[model samples]
Target: MNQEHDAGPGRSGVSRRNFLGGGLVAAAVTPLLTGQAEAKAAAAPTVDGVAQVTVRAAVNGSPVTVRVDPRATLLDTLRERLDLKGTKKGCDRGQCGACTVHVDGRRVLSCLTLAATTTGREVTTIEGLADGDRLHPMQQAFVEHDGLQCGFCTPGQIMSAVAMVDDEGGADSDDEIRERMSGNICRCSAYPRIVDAIRDAQQVMR
Candidate 1:
């Protein structure tokens, strides 16, 4: 005798094939849902319910007033908003001094500094180091000593070197220059020439 079997569903009111199909569908939909949520989150503007504010600051001896998000870094503000591209962004976490700039005549890591904090403060960038067609003393020294290899870190290195010479307890020797300027890392390993350049600039600056 032949027996008839119901292949549509089991006693649990669900078929094995249907169950697997539903599971696969759910798995695919989950990622889509998650991606949509992430996109929405990223598209949202306000940070912690605070909106962007207008910040007025002096950049390279020019007065600038710009609207920036509170969390925007000084590096981004300079490069993106103010159109100052000389300040290179290496390590945005402040580990590298490639984004160095002068804030009130003191060298500060622009990547780690907030744009809003620079309001009403004097900020100087690499472009400001030149007088008309003449390069700054430190910049001239860097070129003469071949202090840069790739030249990506040259701006920050020169900025720091200039500030170092102005400091009361700045580096007076090659070893001191290396130790003091250690925050700025040059992947090209141009330390020897960098030191030479800084020392030469120090005499010229003095």
Candidate 2:
């Protein structure tokens, strides 16, 4: 049966070389494939009324240069690209306080700021709030006062509180701290402990 099949007219001359030679035809088109891939990669993307520029920023005490889209929010730029997961994205439109970060020692809502405009400024997130082996005073206070329930918004809350206390925003009283930090809400409704932790941390930080 094998001999009869092999002896067939057009199949009589089947060889490894013939099969391999046919395969080379597809492989030879790889240059075309590569060109298309390059074209796709180099395709220009449209930018609206925004300028795209590279900025070198001191992030978390470390200098990093990144090409930022003018419309990209600071929260998305840091968490998605810079791998700063400590900054939460509670409300992308800046309603919640979960995306707070420090801009040159002052706390700002990262979800509302554009990444391109923050060039050359110091941007510090919750990841930058802690010291080596020792947590920041705010973090310690939060832990002591149980300021978190689900632990999702804790980083931004602590970071904002730290900046507030450092800036004497919490110097008035517990009510003042609560009012000042009202922008950063704890979804767990842990407002009392949050205020207490800020007050506690302010004393230690002073």
RMSD of each: 16.5, 16.3
At residue 48, what lDDT does model 2 achieve?
33
| Model 1, CA-based lDDT | 0.76
- Please list all clashing residue pairs in model 1, or write none if there are none: none
Error of 2 at 178 (Å): 1.1
TM for every model, in the order presented, reads: 0.76, 0.74
**Model 2 regions lying over 4 Å from their true place:** 1-51
Best by lDDT: 1
List, residue by residue over 1-206, the lDDT tens digit for candidate 2. 11222322235566523543311111211222122343343322223323344546788987776555555677877876677788998977788888999998998998888876787899999888778889988899999999889988888898888888786546678778877888888788988888888888898888
Q: What is the C-alpha lDDT of each candidate?
A: 0.76, 0.71
Off by over 4 Å in 1: 1-49
